[model samples]
Target: MTPTDTRALVAIDLGAESCRVSLLRWLPTGPQCTLVHRFLNNAVETENGLRWKIDAIEAGLMEGLHRCAAIATEGVRSIAVDGWAVDYARLDDDGKAMEDPYCYRDVRNITSEESVHAIIPAAQMRVLTAIGIMRINTLYQLYADKLAGRPQAPWLNLPEYILERLGGRRVSEYTNATHTQLIDMHTGTWATGIFERLELDPEMAAPLVLPGSIVGKVTGELATLPAFADTQLVAPCCHDTASAIAGIPDAADDWAYISSGTWSLVGTLLQEAINTQPAREENLTNFGGAGGRILFHKNVNGMWLLRGCLDVWRAAGKDWSFDELLPLAEAQHTPHHLLDVDDPDLLLPGDMPNRINRQLLERGFGEISTKPEDAPAMTALILHSLAARYAQVLGAIADITGKKLKKLYIVGGGSRNALLNRLTAQATGLEVVVGASESSTLGNFAVQMAAVESSADAETIAEWAGVLRTAF
Candidate 1:
């Protein structure tokens, strides 16, 4: 078999709503990306709690890899995986997952979060980890496992677990690890003090590695195939949000980004960590970014609000598509009462329309009708509320970081919402630049290309990102 037959790269993006597999091949003219496969993904309520269908996820990804081998006749060069952060799989002694990973949205976190704070105050956790204090963070999730008397074993975040399953080493990528709220922001390692205080085992955590580090090559049955024999597994910014941000080719230093999807992360990149009292009080996070930069952002509720409402409408036989709803929403007048987009009640799944109305009634505002015909009005209210929240978060980021933000680049599936973009631009008074919806896939491939060709340093990744942007 010829080793240099092809320079094709594969990128697997695991998302809350859907999982996608994409391929990037170097052509005579430039790089080209193809969507090999995509499938729906959602958490399910199990006897234990809300859990991911990881076995099904693994099977679907394997199918996509086989398809890639068939089409990229020249042979596959490398592979990478990026996805949503905060969820992880605990492994047994035999190096197999004990069970499907828990979904971060489970209600069990509420008690676990309180228990953790009682041991180590929320203020102290922010000071140590520099991450936003959220009940959904992995720190609380792990403690929840302990509180339930689960057996102790090593755990890997979802993305890293996939890489390990593909013959890579067990290690947590920095970008994703920061989301766990267990890393010391100043030292860039696990906060042993917090673990000791909470009595959680520090040894159970995987060693951390930075993005662009290659864990291993393809092994096992697939390695016998010509296309997979020499494939290297690279851990790109394992957090989908970080990869999406890296995919942006913008050169301006004065601009900020919104990785808008299930969650809208609103913030700018910073050279250093900001763990000041005011910054912590604002509930801003300092997630690790590509090239050792800090993704100083706040998590604002995004399309999840609209998605939840859609679920209720679909169950009632409304089944309205975004294509049909966006125009209708755009035509409607501005909503008189905007939602508190970050309301905790709106974060859970099911009956979103009712939950939204309940908040409105309690706040002395008229509720949006949940009738099928009035769906457009609900859409408008959700969009307007999201835009207003984005503006508020961006303003806080600017004040904390002291950066004059000129452009607001919106990436991910949410970028396709023209009405929301227009509202965001109007509310924030910034030049709204719409970025690629598949930014995570693009960023995944860009980092792989940079790592294989030269170095996956900040400069190299940025250059590759610019080159790939032209393909779209």
Candidate 2:
């Protein structure tokens, strides 16, 4: 396949709150992208703990693929999947999941994080991995499984697991693998020293592959469809944040990005890793980006806070949508008390309103009422807190990277939040450029297009990204 081929392409974005399947078709005029399907995705509490229903997620994706097959008479040429990182599925000997993957938010990771730090201090871990030492990271999650004495088995992160399920070989895309915090910062391979120190089996990890590498041709029932007959499964920045960043058309070095969704990743792209003592001290991460760049950033708590609060309100009969709440939140005066948006207690689910109020009370500020009517106040507080946090992180990024950021590109679901965008611009004092709400989808398709056209090198990705942004 090449640039001249007119076959349509498919990009599957598996998000924390929702999953979408997008289709890209090339026509004489230009490229056209259509959102063929989107479905709600949530972790459910079970006898064990919070776990994703991989079966349901797989079904939803398949349904979308069928829709794409039905609509794209040009025939789908290739497919790729990008998603939130960290959480993974343990696989049995036959490559089948042992059970649903544990949600990164599962409380078990708290103990696991403590245990890992006990053996290999957090500072050392950060210097070794050059990744943010967060409890939700794959290292802690896997350590949790080990502490529970769960059977040892090979594992794959969510997006790559989806690709393997679609008949791709078991391999971790480099961008997603770095999020595990088990990869050597310098070597770009599994950190054997960390594995030895933690007593983990290094072989359990899949071999690392660069983005745009074709894993396999589509197989299984879906492959039987005419549109999928020759579809290749390409790994395109399997970490959704990486793909979202790739979707940006601007090639300027004076811009940072916030892949705003369930979590907001605030950072700028760099030519190399920054694993110095100062970088480790700030808890900033250096994730792998498309074209082998470093995604120097900090993970700030994002929409999850508002979503958790909304969940509590909905159960209490408030059921306010963002559309109904944002205006009210904007109409209200700035919150007198700002939250430490990355508060540990706010990371978990359940009773968000109380958790927020508890933080307020602890800080000696008056608590916001949980009444349905006062939800906007809470919403405003969350947005304000997030914006303030973003500004702080961006400041740190500038100081560490020496990049004078002039623009902040907001992408993902939160890009649609005008209120948050305005607040971020005001707080960060940078010109805010609102990118696509489905930027991950655009990046996914862009990579697929690049892979098929020639190669997914830096120049190729940028060219395709520009083309897609224009068409979008």
List, residue by residue over 1-472, the lDDT tens digit for candidate 2.
2377788989999988899998888777888899999999999999999999999999999999999999997798899999999999999888888999999999999899999999999988987888988999999998998999987799999999999999999999999999999999798989989988988888999999999889998998988899999989999999999999999888789999999998999999999999887788789999998888889999999989999988888888989988999999999999887999899999998999999999999999998988887999999999999999999999988988888999999999889999999999999999999999899988887887788778888768877888888656
In candidate 2, where is summed lDDT lowest over 10 consecutive residues?
Answer: 1-10
Q: Backbone clash tally for model 1?
A: 0
- As for candidate 2, its clashing pairs are none
- Weakest lDDT window of 10 consecutive positions for candidate 1: 1-10
- What are the TM-scores, per candidate, against the unseen true structure? 0.98, 0.98
Estimate the overall C-alpha local distance difference test score of candidate 1.
0.90
**Alpha-carbon shift of residue 117 in model 1 (angstroms):** 0.4
Local lDDT at 428 for model 2: 99
Q: Candidate 2 — which residues are off by over 4 angstroms?
A: none
Query: What does candidate 1's lDDT look like per residue over 1-472, in tens digits?
Result: 1113347899999999899989888787777899999999999999989999999999999989989988888788899999999999999886778999999999999999999999888998888899999999999999999999997789999999999999999999999999999999899999999888889899999999999999999888778888898999999999999999889876568999999999999999998999888898889999999888899999999999999988888889989988999999999999888999999998888899999999999999987799988999999999999999999988998998899999999999999999999999999999999999999988887787777777778777877788888655
Q: Which candidate is the best by lDDT?
A: 2
- After best superposition, candidate 2 residue 223: deviation in angstroms? 1.9
**Model 1, stretches more than 4 Å misplaced?**
1-6
